[model samples]
Target: MTIEEQIEKSRTSIFKAVFPNTTNHYDTLFGGTAMQLMDEVAFITATRFSRQKMVTVSSDKIDFTKPIPSGTIVELVGGVKHVGNTSLKVHVDVFIEEMYSSQRESAISGEFTFVAIDEDRNPTTIVSYQ
Candidate 1:
């Protein structure tokens, strides 16, 4: 399914985190760091839906469109974009502050797949959204 398809009718979570002083150098957020945040957001969204812990199985693709500055608000949005027998594909959008304007711009976007696990650490079907 397309990116819009799954999220259009799926559940998700909206998480916000600020860039820490140690999170950036020269006031610019690092791409790797941004991607890690994206993954976490995606996991939170998917696992919350499943009502259990999950592990990332895969990611669709990611692109960095802008730079995030330190001391700015970073908006992390993630949602279920697709679901399978034992997995959920999620989409994440990370936005950075526009500094002076305090506006938000898309900094990075990624899609990841996560599988719910039971107490035994075995893969489990996330049937809530099904």
Candidate 2:
């Protein structure tokens, strides 16, 4: 498949309900929790795109634009942004949706970098999957 096709096919999205347990004392989703979820989505995007062993190398700037309160739903979408010889970048966006109303907005966004690895855990060129 072409690189564009691979990227489009590898787009990933995950949804979760923001419960009290995952929220901070202020009744909003914790920043750390958001980062963790973003990383998970970014990892999945990288793996799906390369279809190989991938590990997170670094996380770029993460911007929290809005607060996600408890009792809301969140959708995390991840897409491949850049691909290198042995590394790739994934951009993740977290959107908040109100449970009782038709309200939705972007709450966070970030970029994560991952490196393809071989069995020996050495960085390897990303092989295009059929």
Candidate 3:
């Protein structure tokens, strides 16, 4: 498949309900928890795109534009943004949706970098077959 096709095919999206256990005293999702979920989505996108073992190396500026309250739903969408010889970047966006309404808004966005790794844990080419 073409690079563009591969990128599109690897896009990942995950949905979760915001419960009290995952929220802070303010009843909003915690920043750390959001970051963890973003990283997980990024990891899945990177691995799907490269079809190789991938490790998160860094997370770029993450902007929390809005608070995600408990009793709401959240959708985390991840897509390949950039690809290099041995690494790639995935952009993740968190969208909040009300359980009772059709309202949805972007709450957070960030970019994560991942490096493809071999069985020996060494950096390898992202697109080995290509």
Candidate 4:
């Protein structure tokens, strides 16, 4: 497969339902919870793209554009944004959808950097084996 094909194939989307337990007192999804979900999605995408043991090194600015109320469904989309020799960047976006209505909007977005590691947990180069 080509590098473009690999990147395209790495695209991932996941859906989650927000419950009271995962929300704040104001009934909105917690920022920390959203970040955890984003990081998970980033890890999966990075692993899929590199086909190696990948670890998150850093997360860029995360913006919460809107509040995600409890009882709503959220879709987290992750895709490869940049590819490097030993690391790559993944962009994750969170979209909120109302449970009983047709309302939907972007709740949060962020970029995460992941580094490919070997068995010893040292950084390694990522090569696309076509």
Per-candidate total of colliding backbone pairs: 0, 0, 0, 0
Model 1 worst lDDT run, 10 consecutive residues: 1-10
Candidate 4: Cα lDDT at 71: 95
- The TM-score, computed over Cα atoms with residue i paired to residue i, of candidate 2 is 0.98
Best by lDDT: 2
Q: Candidate 1 or 2, higher lDDT?
A: 2
lDDT of 1: 0.74
**What local lDDT score does residue 28 receive in model 1, on the 0 to 100 scale?**
74
State the lDDT at 58 in candidate 3. 98
- Residue-level lDDT of model 3, residues 10-125, one tens digit each, is 99999999999999989999999999999999999999999999999999999999999999999999999999999999999999999999999999999999999999999998
TM-score for all models, in order of appearance: 0.76, 0.98, 0.97, 0.97
For 33-112, candidate 2 gives per-residue lDDT tens digits of: 99999999999999999999999999999999999999999999999999999999999999999999999999999999
The candidate, 1 or 4, that scores higher on lDDT is 4
lDDT of each: 0.74, 0.97, 0.95, 0.95
Model 2, 90: alpha-carbon shift in Å? 0.0
Q: Cα RMSD (Å) per model? A: 4.0, 0.8, 1.0, 0.8
Clashes of 1: 0
Please write out the lDDT profile of model 4 over residues 1-130, one tens digit for every residue.
9989999999999999999999998999999999999999999999999889999999999999999999999999999999999999999999999999998999899999999999999999997869
lDDT of 1 at 49: 66
Q: Any residue pairs clashing in model 1, and if so which? A: none
Give the better candidate number (2 or 3) by TM-score. Answer: 2
